[model samples]
Target chain A: MTNASAQAASPPWDDVSITVIRRDMLRFARMQLRDSGAAEDMVQEALMAAMTSAKSFAGRSAFKTWMFAILRNKIVDHIRASSREICGADLAGSSDMDAGLEEFDVLFNRRGLWNPDDRPATWADPEASFEQDAFWTVFDLCMNKLPEHIARVYTMRELLELDTAEICAELGITRSNCFVILHRARLGLRECLENRWFQGEAR
Target chain B: MKMMNCKDATQLMSERYERTLSLRELLSLKVHTAMCKGCSNYGQHLDVLRQASARLRAGNTSGEP
Candidate 1:
């Protein structure tokens, strides 16, 4: 089919190509900001930016991927601008991870322990109880509870679809350190979710 | 079979699972996991968590959340 004919045949937003991706972008924004209003704003901003800069897309990657990249950059910009006061030191130094790690070390050491191995294992069958809204609510709560640095790294890498190398460069961390941060973030989230959603259900 | 320490296994299996490890590192992890129930279980848990998170995120996007 001709490109025009194909384009005409597809619904503007219902087109399978962009529909799910757009939704994912919105969901990611919500998860990252933990505010539906801000998330919707980010989605609209990303959509506008993508549409205006369509020519710059280059088509080297999927359109959704490109759109996500734009959204991620926008999110980072929003976060930076919004936290200007708290992250002034982070903004001044190129190495956010180093500064973040130092802060984490102090906090973590003060807590007198890193691992929560003493806590009971609490695994749930996602297949049965995996309602989306509830999951994200729990997920968001867990993510928000994480240390700021770990959460930032985890969000950028997983939710924003950034490469580890890019995250390392942006956060001024080595690949190994990035993985360590991510691992800790994941472990913490797992425990949090288990306690809040899974185990709580039993009680 | 012996079990890998949680700390070391967490590090090794994480990189291995992400496909970010070098061949040598990957081989070492494979060897370690071969005899390590704890590492194996950790890997399983990580995989489950990843899938569950992705599904949850996708569900939210589709308005099921």
Candidate 2:
């Protein structure tokens, strides 16, 4: 029939497996928006756009690439709109977490050597950890537990893979300060994952 | 400068991703990591973390609803 012929011509957007890309899209959005609720909304919007433009898709590229293109644009718009409040930190006052840096001093002596009790322990079969869903759950929980500003910086630099210049420009921070922030962030995540996932398995 | 220790060596490990290390810094890290079990473990941890980030980039979904 005419209706059957028409349906066959158009790309099957409705039949597309969202399950194929949903988690990655959410992860992508979370790296940008830093809020799970906002990330979900953005992913939803991207999906809607993909569905509506399904006819225009020529199948030249992978469906996931096409969908991600839409999602990236949404993320850019969100960043531009939220740029004003990106830092969301009070410069006038220091936080108790600032004292957390002192903990590093205990790990390193005046000569910068690790104290006997402060050495990092060996982890068992770390690559295999990636295959376990529970490990990722612990990873996510640890990521969320990082101090707010540090977590944002960490996500930008590590997860998003933004260059130092871009991150410094986005956060309105100096080059050295950017490195310092990133260092602290890496240290924080390392310790958290070490304690919760790596060391937890040892027991 | 003071001899690179576990603390300084770990900091260098993180910095390795941002930019190429200088010859001196590179040699120091190699030497430090070679003998220190703790620093070696930390280096491996950094490598694992990088792999996890790479997985996120590749869009390999775990299909968690």
Candidate 3:
């Protein structure tokens, strides 16, 4: 990622380190664009852009966040250029697949109450450091564990901050479908984080 | 208000993020969660996850690695 016209300073990529997070950037791009080829191009563009601005990244913020911000802008810009009409074909994991929802059934009893054994335990004051890299790893792991369709919808709803109508339009799904996907995404994520992060801490 | 089961209440809690609840659904959820410890804790966890997700994206802009 070197530039011939650049100064004597080493490229900030060594500090920013794309090698590790390249997969993450690609995954996020794939989720947004749903086309691996386009996702690859987007990541390439973002990486090139980040390289252009490498000198400014004097470690002012977390490298991954800065890089992701650039990638997200590139992806969002690409989406805007294409708009809703063209996005339907290269969609992420198909939505109607139930997204591993059978696992959730075991959380409740035949009476539709939370089973005593599966009841959620209280997570006490853990507000201090969840944003740290360790916790973000847990978060990422839990997120990755979710089925793609669930993750795709949740990313639209939460990460992209799309509303019901917008998400419905983007995914070409009905409001009910969007809601069900979001519901299962949240349930799965909440349970995963509780077990992997909170309960792990408790133990 | 028609009483709802914990499963129904949990579904409503998640659905609220996508759409505003009808008055009856809202009341049912409130009443059910009020009396149900497990569901109440579940709601709190949901809230935490919501906030975390919002922050995740928002942090991208502010550059929280």
Clashes of 1: 1
Model 3 clash pairs? none
What would you estimate as the lDDT of candidate 2? 0.72
| lDDT by residue for model 1 (B1-65), tens | 34334555556766654556777666766776677554555577677667755653443334354
**TM-scores of all candidate predictions against the true structure:** 0.63, 0.80, 0.72
DockQ of 2: 0.53
Model 3: how far residue B53 lies from native, Å: 1.4
Once fitted onto the true fold, the runs of candidate 2 whose alpha carbons sit more than 4 angstroms away are: A1-16, A53-62, A65-69, A87-106, A115-118, B61-65
DockQ values for all predictions? 0.28, 0.53, 0.40
Q: Could you tell which candidate, 2 or 3, scores higher by TM-score?
A: 2
lDDT of candidate 3 at residue A178, scale 0 to 100: 77
**All models, RMSD in angstroms:** 6.2, 4.4, 6.3
Interface RMSD score of each model = 5.1, 2.7, 4.2
Residue A201 displacement in candidate 3 (angstroms): 1.9
TM-score of 1: 0.63
> How far does residue A3 in candidate 1 sit from its true spot (Å)?
10
DockQ preference between candidates 1 and 2, better one:
2
lDDT of 1: 0.63
Task: Give the count of colliding residue pairs in each prediction.
Answer: 1, 0, 0
Tens digits of lDDT, candidate 3, A1-203:
35553443444456345665676677566655556898799989988998889876655666677787888778667655655654455443353445476778788888888878668888866564354556667777788788766787788677666677876676567778778778888888888888877886755
Please tell me which predicted candidate would have the highest TM-score against the true structure. Answer: 2
